[model samples]
Each structure stands twice: as structure tokens, then as C-alpha cells.
Target: MVAGEPFRMLVDPLATGHCDQWLDLPETSRAGDAAALLDLLFGTDDTLDLVVLRVGTVRHGTASRRLLRGGAKGIDDAAGQTLPGHPRYELIDWRCPVCQTLVWRIHADPRRPPECPEGCGPMGMRRTG
Candidate 1:
């Protein structure tokens, strides 16, 4: 799937902390309930970076600090920890330049630039109405 497409993601609260509740969130829920859930799970936003890692048929976006700390290699490590017998997974990190929006998809291709949802041009033109 291309970036900016709406998708559902399963969150493992326990991965970030000792929580019994698991969250399944829609794309729109990312900044609202999902953000709150991440805060609760990770305890700090510093380590709450969203990384979409695919394992078999399931694609999950887990909160990880590896990306911020370890960069590309860290992403590989984070994917490895998600499931057994896998060495690495694809990473989606595309964001809209105009609005600074994180673009997400079930299977994201980073090569594809995300379109601004607010219709902001490449120059970030704002709507007057």
C-alpha cells in the first residue's frame, strides 16, 4: 500500500511496559487514543517512535526508541525483536513536508512521497475559508 492510506494497527502494550491491555487502532486514532496509549505503554514520548514492522501476514506499528537512537540498524533490531526467526522488516518513515504529518499504510513504500491532506501545496499554502 502507498503512504497516507488508512489502515489498522495492533499495539502491544506489554512490549513497551507491563500492561495487560492491547490496543487495536484505526488510522485516524493515531494522534488521539493511540498517542495516549503509547504514552501509557512507553512511559515517555522520547522512546515512542512509530515503526511499522511486518511479520508474516500481520503488520504492526510498535513504539520503539531504536530508530531515534540506532537509526537504520536500530530499525532492523526492532523488527527482529517483534517476531522469531526474522532478521529484518520493512520500515515506513515517510511524512508530509508541508504539514509535518506522518504518513502510514499497511505496507508502506517510503519512495512514494505523501500528499498533504489539507491540500497544502508543496509550498504549504493555507486555506482561507
Candidate 2:
């Protein structure tokens, strides 16, 4: 650690607030939507203080916010309302970084951390355009 260097805690939009658990905010939205959300919520700020003090601070990120404001009508109404391309259930394949081998495929909740069969723990994969 360096002296005078500020500490920061970074979390995706979902962690900051469970995206799917909210009304009309589908958990299966596209990655671009999530990126847009992160942009709107945490566009730019300082290390001294964060604009979002709590969960409800940044719920108005245009599209999703509009949905939230509309409120969830009912279980039936919200049923099958996920993003067009997103499947109701998505699988995530975790891999071992050291061995560069595929590991296990599981749900994308992320609350459940996946481990490498070879004890490599978890590694982040770079996204390629």
C-alpha cells in the first residue's frame, strides 16, 4: 500500500444492488445494459467521497429506472419478461488460470463462487471485442 493513496471498493451494478431482484430490472439483461448502468450510477467521482451512500441512491439509470418506477404488476406480468436474447437460466464456465483449462459450469448468480478443480482459486477473464 502507498501512503496518501485512497482506498476504493468496486462492485458491479448487480452487487451494488441486485439487478434482477428489482421490479422490471431483468437479471438477464445484456452486458451493455450493465455497463450503461455502471456508467449512469458511477459516471465519475472523487476518492474523498462516493455519491452513492447506499443502495437506493442510484436507481434512476434511465431504462431500468423507468421500469422500477413503473413497479412490478404481478408474478404473471413479470413472468418471461427477461431481456429478449437472455435465457431464463444462464451458465457460467469457470476455468483454471494456471493450467488454462476449463473447470465447472454453473449458474451465474456470482454469490456462489466457483473454484478451480486444481486449487487455482478464481481468476478474471479479459473480454475481447
Give the top-scoring candidate (lDDT): 1
Off by over 4 Å in 1: 1-88, 104-111, 121-129
Error of 1 at 68 (Å): 20
lDDT (10s digit) by residue, model 2, range 1-129: 221111111122333432212111233343333323322332221221112211111232222332322242322133234433344343343445676544222234544443433456764432210
lDDT on C-alpha atoms for all candidate structures: 0.34, 0.30
- TM-scores of the candidates in the order shown: 0.27, 0.25
**Worst 10 contiguous positions by lDDT, candidate 2:** 3-12
State the lDDT of candidate 1 residue by residue for 11-110, as single tens digits.
3333453221122333333222333333333333353455333322233545444432333321232232333212222223334455554433222322
Using TM-score, give the best candidate's number.
1
Off by over 4 Å in 2: 1-86, 104-107, 110-112, 126-129
